[model samples]
Target: DQQVKQNSPSLSVQEGRISILNCDYTNSMFDYFLWYKKYPAEGPTFLISISSIKDKNEDGRFTVFLNKSAKHLSLHIVPSQPGDSAVYFCAAGKYSGAGSYQLTFGKGTKLSVIP
Candidate 1:
């Protein structure tokens, strides 16, 4: 089963604090992992990604860590701002899939950044 799962449906953090989001997956064939941030009524925007061969990746205020052995991943946002409030989706897929890489996405985690 190519199931990506996000345990928390929602999280709230005060501005300037750290926000942590968790995700899990059951598929071993998934070689590429991605995290997307989505605003209301808009498509998800890619945040960070990590390959199965790597343990961690970072982008500015966002960081993603993957623990392949445990099938777990997490996204950390430091100094969270109100603009960071949005739904985050954790997705996984193989690189060689059909034409476009089909992403298996978690239900989604809503991050509420308080001012």
Candidate 2:
């Protein structure tokens, strides 16, 4: 069974608007969640993260919210720009003793920010 799932295959947003991407996980052991953004030909770059201990985390234009009881999480980006158009992946993980994360990722959702 897939542990992490991004139900929406794609999303579109107008410039300067808000874009919200949702994710779900089945594994209770996952204590950390990460969002990654990928361009057409480049590697996925880390965007935001949230620890299960916290309900929310924010950095600049990005914010992540975790609803542990619902086994769900979401990434919100305000004032979305064209540069933000990319594939976003949701990853769930457990922090290991070494402070590393063992993650399971979703298929990813393609985001289009229309100018």
Candidate 3:
């Protein structure tokens, strides 16, 4: 079973509107959650992250919310732009015994911002 899951395969939004992406995780060991945006072929770029200690984290147009009890998280983009169209992946990581971080990633949600 996938530890991290993105229920929606894709999302479409009009420019200047808000885009909300959802994710869920089954691993309670995961304390650190992150959102990444990926282009066609390039690697995913880090977007926002929230530690289990915080309920919300915001940066500019991007906001991330984490609910530890619910095992759920979401990313909100305000005034979505054409340039914001990309595939978003939700990832969770935890510190391992070997001092390494093991991460599990959701499939992805492709966001299309129509102009």
Candidate 4:
């Protein structure tokens, strides 16, 4: 079974409005989480991230919230713009015994920001 899951397949928001995307994970070992945005034919670009030690992290219009007790997380985009429309994916990373972390990504949620 997949460790990370994004329930909503897509979402639409008007420009200058708020866009919210949710994700869930079943792995208790995951100590870090990240949100990425991807455009068609291009690789995903890192957006924001939260560590197990922190409940939230924010950058500009992007914010990532983590709820360890619920094994869930969400991303918020405020004042959304048309350029923000893209496929967003949430990923979980667990520290392996070998000294590195392995990541598992959710299916993704396509967000459309209308003008």
Cα RMSD, each candidate: 1.5, 1.7, 0.6, 0.8
- Model-by-model lDDT, in order? 0.93, 0.96, 0.96, 0.95
Better of 1 and 2 by lDDT: 2
Residue-by-residue lDDT tens digits, candidate 4, 1-115: 9899999999999999999999999989999999999999999999999999999999999989899999999999998999999999999998887897788999999999999
Report the C-alpha lDDT of model 3 over 4-63, residue by residue, as the tens digit: 999999999999999999999998899999999999989999999999999999999999
The whole-model C-alpha lDDT of candidate 4 against the native structure comes to 0.95
Looking at model 2, which ten-residue stretch has the lowest summed lDDT?
93-102
lDDT of 2: 0.96
* Candidate 4 wrong stretches, greater than 4 Å: none
Worst 10 residues of 4 by lDDT: 94-103
Error of 1 at 86 (Å): 0.2
Please, what is the TM-score per model?
Answer: 0.93, 0.94, 0.98, 0.97
> After aligning candidate 3 to the native by TM-score, how far in Å is the CA of 35 from where it should be?
0.4
- Report the C-alpha lDDT of model 1 over 1-115, residue by residue, as the tens digit: 5389998999999999999999999989899999999999998999999989999898899999999989999999998999999999999987564676778899999999999
- TM value for model 4: 0.97
Clashes of 4: 0
